[model samples]
Target: AELEIERWKNENAPPNLPELKEHLQTKKTAFVLQEKRLKRLRLLIDSNKFAEARSEISQWKKTGEDLSGLSEMILNLEHIEKSDDIVLDLKRGLAWQKYPDSYIQNLKMAVDRCKSIQSIPRKSFNWRIPSKDELLLFFTSNIESKVQYNSGSYWSSTTDKVWSDYNWIVESKSSSLVRTLKDDYKFVICVTDASSEMIYHYLDTLKF
Candidate 1:
């Protein structure tokens, strides 16, 4: 009778028990690690180490971790930062950031950093190199003459459609439009529509 009952229990047991156990263990381990990370991030935030916290989140994303909850929290923090930003308004429904250089100096890095803001439109620019004609006309205009700015080379978003590797450029000293390779990094000045939030989060770290 004992032997018969043992055989019955075995037959009724769930199939693939080993696989299920492995999967459950994997999930448990992941949960534990996630909890540890969450605690660390919270500590970082409380300590006013937001940059480190943001860097940690970025590292996790690069590792392909599911960070939706953390990302949402960070977004809330960014919103607070945005509200505190010094947004400058200009004529003709235009907005400009007070500082010229971006937190990340490279063109691609600048663009990518600009794109991270959810409060603003997608692919929003904090700075861009003005077009040759635009820069020329701008500097030549009475309005530009009144404003004191240094003459330098700046990066423009205008890329040659026919040549994917080339981009248009403007020199503050002259009005001619020039073409350059995409890899060359140059100075950038950002502008936005009047409605944009124009948050420059890294500006606080800058001395100027």
Candidate 2:
């Protein structure tokens, strides 16, 4: 709309048609307002605020303004929560399980438990118990990812250097890591590395 108004202004004289000039100016103003709203929508998406982004799109639609490709983008946002319930972090080369396993047990068994899920999500992520550093990534990424786990005190592959039987575990509720004995019960979340080709396809789907 803004470009159209600019073209009209360039091709026509301003004083000859006052009504047309007013219409063009009005269109330019509306486009600017929409551009601002679109910026906000992008910010929301970048922050992993899909629910709010959906609301924004709905409200915009109610106003009767076309969002062009953005509307289709929102419509297909379900691609993130595909059949496997995996969320991809292409930048980190990781695929995170959207939910944790229900059987919260001793840390000693966490690794083996996670191994069972390796075949899930097409085994593309090679899912298994994450390392301490890898698990730490979850804490920092929590806000930026749509994945959420109900269980807390997740086990990590990294064991305590000082204690042979202790491993570091992350608490979902507190977002903190604490060293715990192998016998301590905790939840499990599997993670795997993402491939470059997978990233390419994901980006292609989003048309970004």
Candidate 2 regions with alpha-carbon error over 4 angstroms = 1-84, 118-125, 142-145, 197-208
Provide the TM-score for each candidate, comma-separated: 0.40, 0.50
What C-alpha lDDT do the candidate models reach, one value each? 0.52, 0.66
Candidate 2, residue 88: how far the Cα is off, in Å: 0.6
**Could you tell me the lDDT of residue 83 within candidate 1?**
45
* Model 2 lDDT per residue over 63-160, tens place: 44344444444433433434457777767767777766777888657777666773443323455788987777777775225776765678888889
Q: Which portions of model 1 miss their true places by more than 4 Å?
A: 1-91, 102-104, 113-137, 142-150, 195-208
Worst 10 residues of 2 by lDDT: 199-208
Q: How many residue pairs clash in each candidate?
A: 4, 0
Kindly report which residue pairs in candidate 2 clash with one another: none
State the weakest 10-residue window (summed lDDT) of model 1. 199-208
Error of 1 at 79 (Å): 14
Q: Pick the candidate with the highest TM-score.
A: 2
Model 2's lDDT to the true fold? 0.66
lDDT of 1 by residue, 1-208 (tens): 3344446566874565556666767777776876676668667766646667777777653444344444444544443345433243333334333444432245675565445444443333333444554555554554454433456666677778899888776676775677877787766655444321222232122221
